[model samples]
Target: MSAVSESISRRVTLGYIASHYGFELEPRFADGVTVTSVADTPDSVRPGALYVLRDDEEPSWLSVAVSRGAYAVLVPPSMAASARSAGVPALLATPDKATLGALAADIAGTPANTMAVFVVCGVEDDEIQADVVRVADFLHMLGNPVGIVSASGSSSLERELDMSYPLGILDIQHLLAVCSEDGAAAMVISADSQTLRPGALEGVNVDVLGTIEQLDRGGSQRAFKETRQRYGFSIDEQKRLVTCTEESGWLAGQASASRDLQSQRRLSLAIAMAMDAGVRRSNIRNALRVSKEMR
Candidate 1:
């Protein structure tokens, strides 16, 4: 049920979304009409959209989506049974199911393999990547294709980005989905006061919350690095590539060699951070070029 790398059959049907969500389509809608797109809420519904109705809030909008030519409706069991009995094309699953997160992540892809979440703090907004422009600038210098999920729409990322999430509304469920896509080397989500502060990440997965902070990036690198295990990073001791993580072994450990000591240090840190952040190894080399020093 993965959204990426999973072979999708042509001719999407209601049965598809149903089976993916652990639901059974009733006999009336068993055959199911095909769907071209999906709209999780009623207002966002488009013609031929598959409406994923939220908990009992069945506003009259469901009928509106259907009237506007939505192919089918996906809902929890109580509503589904009612709809089916009334001849509405709906499928059913339990209400407030625990498997919803698992289902969403399953379709989005495993975050562990494809995503990186960071929570950087301990500095003023000016000193750290405080805005989208600085964040995008930092990412560009890091040399890996990256996405920005921002709350305030002031970053260069606000204009254009490989992938963008507005208002920093990204969750593991959504993030896993983004990471499951092709060309997605890494998904670097911006941390805000809401996410970076205490108790913000109370219920979040530690694996996803497992952070890589303490960026000692100076001048060039404002560097990025990853940590998976001991003896993995390519940095030499006191200018030598030492600490190697699963991600730090990239480029055969060439992150240590550079003419400019500052550039070497920065690029080394950048490579490691990008890799740690889930940037693809192949893409890391290009991002290693120092673009600008942190101001």
Candidate 2:
């Protein structure tokens, strides 16, 4: 197991998290404090686990919880000073939840950085699903074990991928954290991207999907070509691929005669995405026919 997988398996120390945030730990709760996980609700608290609390939450309850078994507390923003004064044993403080998540993952050593991180950023909801299928399928075919960070909403793709993550806990920080995970192939979808911060993953090469060229960049053509060469994609298949490569191309073609394929339980969304991108359904069927699953 990797550092991240191992981290998840074992408990981490409060000093570890504080070190990542560059915060000095109070001597009282400084060393020998180990946490199992980041607790969401107080009821799920485990011995030596960290939990973040809002300023408005009941401090008495938090105090009581810590007294019982909680490892450490991260006071939100201004409350940290106050929390410290109140003897909360606040190990670290941060206003931004995203920042907190990033710091925590940094201490714990996330495994996403080692994987292929793909994001379908800066697009509308309608345009996202089709692109997700294309890019994810492309990664799947490249012999990577795909782990999808499904940002809620889309039901079909969520059900289709066995290893899927719910969008509720996924933020930019979470995405960045996951990007560090080893042996990971991730795809994230978002409806809006106008204000996406500059230099956000600037140096990183993410296969941003949603356009025809983007589709090809994400390995749609590669998968298609490999499939075609192995069997044979004739003129009809070639024509189909051309027609559907662009969002406008396929959206317009699929507009009049729309097929709601959610009804088919066994059908992989990867196949749907390929077909939506203009690979002939027959060609996809052929590719699957020669594969172990189809056999």
Q: Compute the lDDT of residue 57 as modeled in candidate 1.
A: 67
Residue-wise C-alpha lDDT for candidate 2, range 1-295, written one tens digit per residue: 0111223424666676667566656654565676665544465455565666655677655665576456677665555565565554566455354454454454444433444444443225334455554556554553445545444332222243222222222233334344433345454343222313322222222333233223444365564444333221122342222223333343333322325433121124344344543456555544544453433
Model 1 per-residue lDDT tens digits across residues 26-68: 6644556766544455554556655666675654556766765
Give lDDT for model 1.
Answer: 0.41
- Models 1 onward score TM values of 0.51, 0.52
TM-score for predicted model 1 compared with the true structure? 0.51
Cα RMSD (Å) between model 2 and the true structure?
A: 11.7
Give the clash total for candidate 2: 11
Q: So what's the TM-score on candidate 2?
A: 0.52
Q: Which 10 consecutive positions of candidate 1 have the poorest summed lDDT?
A: 227-236
Best by lDDT: 2
